[model samples]
Target: MTITATRSTELDQHRELNADETAVKSVRARIAEAGVEYVYYQIVTLTGRVVGKVVPARHLPRNIEHGIQAHPGVVADLQVDGSGAMLAGSPERGECVVLPDLDSFGVLPWDTRTGFFFCRMYEPDHAPGDDGGRPVPIDARGNLRRVHAGFTARTGLEMRSGIEPEVTWEVPGLSTEHVPGTPHTMYHLEHMERLRPVYQKVIEYGRALGLDMIEGNCEDPGQLELNWMFDHADRTADRLILHRQICRRVAREAGATVSFMPKPADDRFGNGCHHNISLWDGERNVFVDPDVPGLHLTQTGKDALGGILTHAAASTAVMGPTVNSYKRYLHTGQFAPLEINWGMDNKTCAVRMPANGRLEIKSPDSMVNPYLSHAVLLAAVEDGLTQGIDPGLPRTTGTGVPSPFGSLPLTLKDALDLFAVDQAVARGLGSELADLFLRLKTREWERFCASVTDWERRMYGAEGC
Candidate 1:
């Protein structure tokens, strides 16, 4: 029941099986009622990719007790460099056990006969810990839980978040033509009608998978942003991953390719995964109504902002996560943050206080792994709280913001460099995870730097100048 910063083996499979007895009975009843034939035992990788195994529902009881086997590399995207060399570790290395989080079991609404459950991974035949079989260090889900537990233990507060995920959909060779006065548009009802079928399916499937689908709207030419009710940080992260899967499934049937790319096109607004966060103590919102001035956020909220802004530059490596991600930040007027300042109800800063109760981090793109994002923030906030970190005054005018402190790292490379050396971030993520993550991302940046791109060709292809 407890997750520590150093070890998570405190949760044993047998212990989970015992604690999940009620969940087992409930899932079994639902399985029989729904006639589910197969169940997928899945886990999210460091890059937020869903990977897992499929087993017949008849074997559910056995799987619940013993779990399934998966290669360790998959937890790190089974990454490869430009030369096809594995980045984190060899694919031929040993495997790990993937155990189901019983409460996460849900029937796939798209196909009622099949069910799914998100899993937490551990080393093969080993109990999770520093001495025992350690939880896979590169496993983002497990790491997030560890960080969340540490935060709760230190502060006795629960973090809650609601995520706004925006993505683009494109059907190959589709024409712009539509009925007169029904042109493609942003926030127009007619355009919503045009995309309704696709998103409707997404919403339906999302709700079935426990998304609590609240609403959605068209943002760009082919972009849509959907929202869901907020919950504990861990559950919200799981739902975000499931939301991506649901969107992809819905888009596939419509014969369209879906992209969570931060900047899918040069001329339009990029897709962003904005996180709205608040903290709770029992039933009360601790981030609100302390009668603080300016944004009216409590001292605790300000401390959290201080921690987030302090770690903003280093954290961008995960929040943005790719070369193209920085492109979205570089553009002006796209509502992307180019600086690390926090502001009152302003979308231009990296951390925005949109209301008195919570803070919205604007830097995370659609590609972010919610687990990592939340974990890093938890670490930063914990640091702020323990050290009594101050967030400084909110920037009322964009021009009045000071230089250097106000800016974030300009590129993935810069972000990685900062992440590698930051003691606070390293301690937050655990040295083992922080080192492996740096290796994975450094490999990505290296690959991008070595590749010759269309931009290079366009600028250099003219006859020798």
Candidate 2:
């Protein structure tokens, strides 16, 4: 995905730290053991800076409920400035806050803090304009909330999601490319050995943290998938984010680097995070059609699929947000969709309905922000519904459309240029964030453009320098 050059900002790098002891006692127990001095969360703005920070601990003393209703200025602090630097504001730099998200608290395996709670930052009523407000625009979590609200408001249909993230293993001595396509290695054996223990731990952590969590090892070598037990949309996305960090931390301790990059290697398979989303109406599965032959998706499913396919090109900047992500699109006549079309059970189509209610978008890989990307997907779906687009004649195979989808930006330069004029996308992401996202991504593109790679140096020799 690309951004215009006008929007870069600085960011912080410090790792955020938050601890809670659900097993031993509560937030109180963790504090007694490790000193409940403060809780930390990673702050990313729709626009502006994205950083890691510790938030005000005033809520810690006030009680758990107050912690959930954190103030807006502090929530504004959640977003990093345009530079990607971490924030060290006075409220965030010092003091312990009692974080109480029963659904969010978990002891990350690698970090081993015993208790970590992903929180909702809030500002005091007297602190700013829009009393008791939060950085509403920056809240990716809020986007999910609205999505859930949209579903409920429309059809009493609620949605739950399970994110499938794949990875290629890499070590200090070996490149990630070497491991994924290694013909000599046992099938998916390496990732399994490392992930099983973490899976068990996630189960335990899920119980304590009130997370609906289930861990599964997929068929891909060195790749793993985590499924949160079905819940409301907000909880699903939250668990997915925090769970990913937990997986990364645990894997690091196992002497491996795990990345959600769209394509980690050219020789071997690439990694993509396929999200499994199901809608439930009360206790009934709204997506399932048992009697209607071959699990034919209902009309609603088709519309949702249409939303994804129609917006695939425009959504590429966010869905396939990273440069490495495009590599996954190079389909080798194998399983995996690179094109922006939809077919029934077609893995090659960007959007697929494995069944009538099972809506799957294959384009979202490991690189982009899950929360943000999912929001965009919902926005696309919203558009499809509002626009009454029909996903006619389901396809189950790649159509081999040689032409590029609306000329996808091949590099950072291309992305920024396209993003600058993507009015529909800009409206969905909102003005502030759209500007910030464009600016930051644009800056990164320039960083690449202004530099010389070894390939360029070798080809041009001394003249290039």
Q: Which digits, one per residue and each the tens of the lDDT, describe model 1 over residues 1-465?
A: 987764435346444663566778899999999999999999987788999999999998788877898887786787876688776668666677777888888998878899988887777655333535557777788888888887888899989999899998875554333344654466877667778788888888887777888988986777889899999999999999888988888877898888999987777688999888898998899888755566587888888878888888888888998888998999888799987888888777888888877899988999999998898888888888777779888878747647345677789999999999878888767887788788888888888888998878877877523
Q: Per-candidate TM vs. native?
A: 0.91, 0.73
TM-score of 1: 0.91
lDDT of 2 by residue, 189-258 (tens): 5645545665566456555555666556644545556555666556666665665566566556657677
- Runs of candidate 2 exceeding 4 Å displacement: 1-38, 41-59, 63-103, 107-114, 121-134, 171-215, 218-221, 226-230, 331-336, 397-409, 412-424, 462-465
What TM-score should be assigned to candidate 2? Answer: 0.73
Off by over 4 Å in 1: 1-15, 81-85, 126-131, 171-184, 290-295, 462-465
